[model samples]
Target: MIATVVSSYPKIPNRPSPARLRNAINRFDRGAITEEEIRRIEDEVTEEALQQQAEAGLDLVTDGQIRWEDEQTYLARQLNGISLNGLTRWFDTNMYYRQPVIEGAITWQKPITVDDYRFAVEHSEKPVKAVLTGPYTLARLSVDQHYGSVGALAKAYAGALNREAKALQEAGATLIQFNEPAILQHKREFEQFAGLCRSLVDGITVETSLYLYFGDAEGIYPQILDLPFQLIGLDFVMGAKNEALLQSAPFTKKLGLGIIDARNTKLESVDEIAERIRSLAAGLASDQIHVSPSAGLEFLPREVAQEKLRRLAQGVRQAEAVLV
Candidate 1:
């Protein structure tokens, strides 16, 4: 079993030292910092995030999405035919993300994250997993003013992301993930969303993941077991019912069992985390399991998130030792 983060890690800096990234963004907002200066600060924090993951002894790492303003707008800003307007509350979280307003046909103008992924791969000791906002989630969250039909809007987003996925693969990303928390929330739309995801990853050769969080996936249980992607990340922390569902229908497909709680500040004991991993692994091959946090750690302070990753890695090792 491996310890990996779901999508993002806390990008906030620990206290005592100044929050350069936060300060830089505030400076930029006031037209004080240059675009180049803001990017430089982003790079510095991205490196710090990657270094924290490496120090925690994770087998895989993400860029921590330090450059992303939010889950949706980062990718949307790169695509044509969309303009971001007004902040909207993101699901139940207190955080707000800029809403994308579609005005014309969506098209992928250039590589959205290839350069960013390459930078992470270059700096990190571990293999970096590239992440993209899933098309279904993007379509669901965004307001369509031009495309009238949801199907057309989803397909257009899917088409654009499909190209982006291929570009990441060609540029040497072994693993890429699509964040689709919207899927579990709108369970009735699973069939259509799954079909859209399947079409998005049709010919991409590299391994891919459809990461679902924010709620339980009980409604799509065994069907998720049959997904074409190489891995599926589900939130077992908030989606606790999924534990019972998985036990009722076990499979050998790689499952990212979210055992560590990223939402809380207190650290989960390594023994407790190991027990959850052990209980979850009893239903499948131990090698097919990857322990992760409930969701992104963006809400937590950086110090807490770093310790969580360390505990996660320790828990995996303990579980593996017992299994062996």
Candidate 2:
């Protein structure tokens, strides 16, 4: 399906807008402010960001992760297996995640799709992807509460989340992406995680995509080639070397080439990024490629992020011109 989508692809630039920032602010202010205030802000900011993506010429637009607290905790809230804990130090980066602590056996909190799909349909004309953190990644990031192996915990989480994905599909979502940045940490287990993820949404109408970021994807390249997902997101900012991995791996999966560095504030030039995309697309056909930022766009200031996305989207156009 990604191959078909890319075949006669329009000249579109994809970028993250101010939506994630507004969501972050709302996450922090949730208990402090009224629930009505949260909904109003989410609607207002999401509307503006969706318009900005369309105006910026983004081909495929996301909610910029506006509805998430962080990636993992968002799923935690939706699934009954865990509870959200306050921030904890991330390994090396200045980043800290709102951790999810497993409190009991896994279960769906309720039907998890209504609000996300409703918002996407209401806001954007372009295809909107419903994003969730993969269950295995969530379990890996969390400390086990008497569960023997992390894999067991991950599989349990996967079942509940896949149901959520199914619900999203029924509610009019056309694409559903599960973000699994932690999969890079467990190379030996990557394929199993991917398989488990695949099982969750197998027959669902939504086109499924899996995203990995924040680490070199070299070790997991071969493992990913056989997965059944329609699209795979790679973090070029951190995994540029994985560009070579793409050349070696023989698969027809759509590449979500994350060309923009999302964690930094300094805007990258269109020329530099265009050059990289040209080199990266050397063997890959135009139909095999899709472009995005390294990860979510909340790392930079709202203005910086906007500039970065604009340049990234423009860079793709410049690269396509060069290729043609």
Error of 1 at 89 (Å): 0.7
Residue 179 lDDT, candidate 1, scale 0-100: 83
How well does each candidate superpose onto the true structure, as a TM-score? 0.97, 0.86
How many clashes (backbone N, Cα, C below 3 Å) per candidate?
0, 2
The segments of candidate 2 whose C-alpha lies over 4 angstroms from its true place after superposition are 1-33
Q: Whole-model lDDT, candidate 2?
A: 0.71
The window of 10 residues in a row where model 2 has the poorest summed lDDT is 1-10
lDDT of 2 by residue, 40-62 (tens): 77666677667666666677777
Candidates' C-alpha lDDT: 0.88, 0.71
Look at candidate 1 and give me any clashing residue pairs: none
Compared with the true structure, what per-residue lDDT tens digits does model 1 show for residues 151-232?
A: 6788899999999999999999999888889888888877887779888997898888878888888888888867778888
